[model samples]
Target: MKKYSALLILGILFLILAACGSNDNSESSGGSGDSAPASNGNASSEKENQEEPAITNAIIRVAMKSEVDSLDPYQASATDTGIMMDNVFDGLFDTDENGELIPNLASDYQISEDNLTYTFTLIENATFHNGEDFTAEDVVYSYSRLAGLETGEPLSDKWAVVENVEATGDYEVKVTLKSVDSGFLARTIIAILPEGYEEQETHPIGAGPFKFVDYRPGQSLLLERNDDYYMEDKVPQAAEIEFVLMPDTQTAVLALQAGDIDIIPGVNAQQLMQLDDSVTTLSGPSNMPVIFGLNHAVEPLNDINVRKAINLAIDKDEIINTVMQGSATKIDSNFSPAMAFFYEDSVEGYYETDVEAAKELLAEAGYPDGFDLKMTVPSHATMYTDSAQIIADQLGKANINVTLDPVEWSTWLEQVYTDFNHESTIIGLTGKIDPYDVLIRFVDGYSRNFINYNNAEYNEMIEKAILETDDNERATHYKRAQEILAEDAASVFIMDPDSNTVMRDGVTGLKHYPIGKLNLEDLSITK
Candidate 1:
């Protein structure tokens, strides 16, 4: 798209050059009016016969649930922020239109005989947004910081296995892992930065298809095209992408109708029906599962019987058909079936709905009259609030008095997620390409395990799954880990709804990955 913008500017310059050359030719004719009259007549006739060229409008406006919590890739918490960063930063590896693993910064690589070390040959000629040459040292810095070498605490537990990282050559990076992982390729897509850039969290810079322009909290984020991107062929097609915060679905649908926005991602089926004929829709299964998360450390929920009763009371199939309009996949565990390679249907139909049985379980747990429960939910999207209402109604049927508490996204993030101060909450656990990334948040001792779930056997299974180098062996361990989560009734597992992407008349090119992320490079818009 940026290429087309450059070509259009050049075409206008060419027209100016032609007019100047005509004047020069006429001046060289020694003030003769003969050639001037003929030239003017031809120009007029040409203008009358030929139509003007149409300039393409290469810009797209997308909707965001809220402002990006952080600009730094390693520190970002909001899903929308991660999507924005994917366009502003280039990773060592990236996914294709079909969501397959492909090289981005690193051209190729080799693994050691014991499968503990990987040496990557970086691609030369790639430069950062600050005009610095990208080298292996930058990769080392990013990986080292990720593993708590720079900071006392690791930002995420997923990268805790990285034992060592060093620059073997200017463009060669070597990384040694504490354990063997067959799914480590997906982890290679982390954002790469300069060796010592300090303002990344405030004013970020990267060698991506897009560059950060401006951001305003609760309003919008603006990004401009990177014309000098390393891979010219893969430059973003859109000249600019503006993420407009649209916390309300109805308001966003109105914006799309008024031609103020070009796209609204993750729209439900009901929202799609409100649009007219001047729109296109792309639908596919999303890896994120809408879960009713229970606090295992809280009262009543700490008991296994009470947790099982809650799980048995809520009907997942009804939520899929009614709340999701039959557009979601019924999930029994944390792992989504969209990632078929590592997913197994081991716990399917395990908890059939029985309200009487749920009440009996409550009675067995010494809560015959049922206890009062407060469900904290984020009110950014009706997708969550609506489901919470239905689930709350379902729980009430089992004689469990429920109180609905809807809070803003930020408050929910701070209190319910970070503080873990609530009994239960409704949230979507976004998926990643790797299986471990999906389940790591629930594992014991994990910093992000806010659910407070602790099981020795489950932790041991996760350890075995990550260390096993063989694919089949790892699958066995992962499947058992998921089964353990189900047997313990860790949480009320919901459905993985289809990602419905709504675009205006001229917008196109939306890709679906195994992870929950959006890439704006392939999207194009026409005037």
Candidate 2:
């Protein structure tokens, strides 16, 4: 019996070795088996069971004029910068497809009876890309970091209302404000950073659908989809997203035409008109207002009559038609048409081609001899150059000698904000959802307020409107503020041009936001 058992074990071992050798040979030969029908049948069955593509593997190439400066949302200075950060990082609250504020990181939020306090309840399943669970601590960390109470540069005016933020529970945060701010909800559009986020020096970990893969400064930023994202159902259509930075609009347009890029966000009017039929243009009413900014610190600008003369001198209709190429519409007030309640039609605009009236105002301001003024502008931007030339021509008609000083954007921003080298310049400002945001950034005591146009009464009214809980009263206050700005002629409220985006034929599911963000999550390549 022992001899028989030994023989059987040897036979079993030989069989196992033979099977393994056959399997290895099959793999090596690329599964080419003619002798065994069963093996061939098994191979066919396995091939049929393979899953189809998830539509997430397709990479969508996009073109942008300016490179994303910072991944940190709170520190973003430009619209493109904010858009890039927004894609990889979500805020506690975000606007939905319908342009309404909806919950994002926070499951639900509520305001206190006095409107001075806000409570946010976090979603239990929300987790950062690093697998760290989100909590109220993260919210506190983000807000504090943005307020520059920690490591970031301070945004004093934006954070002035916040008294303190406390983690009342593990997933609940209560923020107590120094005063009631009606614009608090709108301001919460900033991205929420993770707790102890400052520890990360190289990259940031976010709870967004996409993760930052790499960034080549002045070149491009690469992002990949997060497979472990909490909302997998709303997954991005692409496996990877590449933001190739083409600073020059002409070069960007050429690249798009050559099929080197799929989309460009900041294509000017001339570039759009030159695009071939292969690309489709998407445009909408933007919050940005193109205007002529006056340096109130300058001698003549300090005089109301001089400011009014400058405002009356320009022919906005001609500028919009010629320089903007009919892509823009003349706006009477700084407030956008989208802001229905705050935008008062009663606030008259200076659109008429009143060369005679302009001359009259200039002469009335004791400039009958026509004074010479230096106008500084960013050379790269087409709109600024064209507007400056138009204004210079019109001012010449009024006998005002205007010298155009076109400089690079960096140099222009520095001189305009700090040096105050020039008396006036033509520029575009990205409008905010609320009137206070516009007023605070431009008219209030902020860095953008190089114009030095300030009124205690106007400021007080803006403050009241922001803190007022009643919607009707808030609208009334905002209207009054707009009236004050228009009456003073502190800034020339030029055209509010429509934002446009050109895309290739295959790209679909892309949507336009009023804020000018090109959302790519819903986009897919049908071709």
Candidate 3:
């Protein structure tokens, strides 16, 4: 059966290639430039008219999988919500298209010689969506509110390194750190809330390109373009943006194909393959890692041999090929190829599928009969569930009994991190544009290390790497940490699939940013 499937896939690839050759005219539907129109006829003219519009009145309908948990920027965990909030709110610093840190709310920032303190000079003309002039006090207020002393949610662990955040002047905010942390700048990617946001959770205000208009819980979120935006000079072409929540991928894809939604930010691999050529597909490296997290503190997994066996049992290539439909690249390490540094080629991937070896290891660990295991997964995460199924099936081939318990994302997160048990589960780790961004959250034992898998040796090494100012030494320490993680089988690393976004051909100026963000500022639609 596998042989027949392989042959069918080869034949399909050949047919696709042959079709590509004959469809040259269809391939060149639009001009080859960032500003080029996706469709012909009056598109250029319509865009030109909107360029200097008598009234900037255009709506962009976007389909997303889930609604946001909280409007408070510091409290958001879902990427779907993060992307929306990120565009609607400005941070102290923002990453450009190339993933390089650039000034946003902060015009200029200076780090002290000791690197423990950073001072940011806020832009003078910036204002919140509510028309309040943005001041250094707003920055101080934003950070202080997330510090758990006020919000009591304990979401400010990312900024816990900062000892103090004070307004030195009308436009200058000074932040003092407990120690020199490498991820300080990237961590600033967290959206900054307007003053008194804790009291105004229902009506959050931000200094971003778009302002919050209305939000119907579990249905949709509406945002109107900020006409009086600080960066109005470089206005986002759309007049208003609507984020409509759809529960599943099939519905999201159907909405996009039916022209009900102009954009689907994150499209699943299977859905991307099924999309028509008329739809513009953007592919980029996702700064996320998919892994089967093991609870080493619990039984069965406490044995390193059992963990190693499970890692070797599942075939990552098969998962990427069958489950992901070749949309993903099999990954050996935690870092994505998008991250320029620390993605060492020498790091070997553990993708070898060997049922015999897995069984041998299980037997060596006194489980020759193959023990029963339960895997917890979120139904919303299609890819994670698919990967889990593949792993479960593969384990069954080795005489291992596996059961899948799928739950909602909220319940899954709560169980996986806080109330973790011996049950193995599949979850994805994202938000690692920089290596430090990953280390601070995963390895440093500070934030989101939800499984509570901590080692003093690992923590010491991570701390040393963060404090080390030398780039080379930091890289070395990070590499050591990654190697230790792989050797210890902390988690079964899976492939990092290519991130996908599907938009109609009529949509223009949709640029792919490296950090998995859709910059709709320059986007425009023309019939």
Supply every candidate's count of residue pairs whose N, Cα or C atoms clash at under 3 angstroms: 1, 0, 0
Q: Residues 205-293, candidate 1, lDDT per residue (tens digit)?
A: 98888998988888988998888898877677788889998877678789999999887766777777777767766555556766788
Q: What C-alpha lDDT values do all the predictions have?
A: 0.72, 0.64, 0.65
Total residue pair clashes for candidate 2: 0
Q: Which number leads on TM-score? A: 1
Q: Which stretches of candidate 2 lie over 4 Å from their true place?
A: 1-54, 148-154, 199-202, 417-422
lDDT of 2 by residue, 112-190 (tens): 7787888877777788878888889999887776566654455656786777788999998888888888777676766
Clashing pairs in 2: none
**Model 3 superposed RMSD (Cα):** 11.1
Identify the superior model by lDDT, candidate 2 or candidate 3.
Answer: 3
Instruction: Name the top lDDT candidate.
Output: 1
lDDT of 3 by residue, 1-527 (tens): 01121112122112111211000000000000001112221121222333432324778888776566667666566666666766688887766554556667877777788888878777899888877889998888877765553655545565666678899999988888888886676667667777765534577778888888888988899888887878766567688899897767678888888888887756666676677777866555454666777777677887888888888888888877876677555666665544545655555665477889999999999999999988887676566677788889988988778899987666665566546643787765653445665655455445456545566666776788778766667777777777767777777877555555667766766655545455767676664
Please state every model's RMSD to the true fold in angstroms: 15.7, 18.9, 11.1
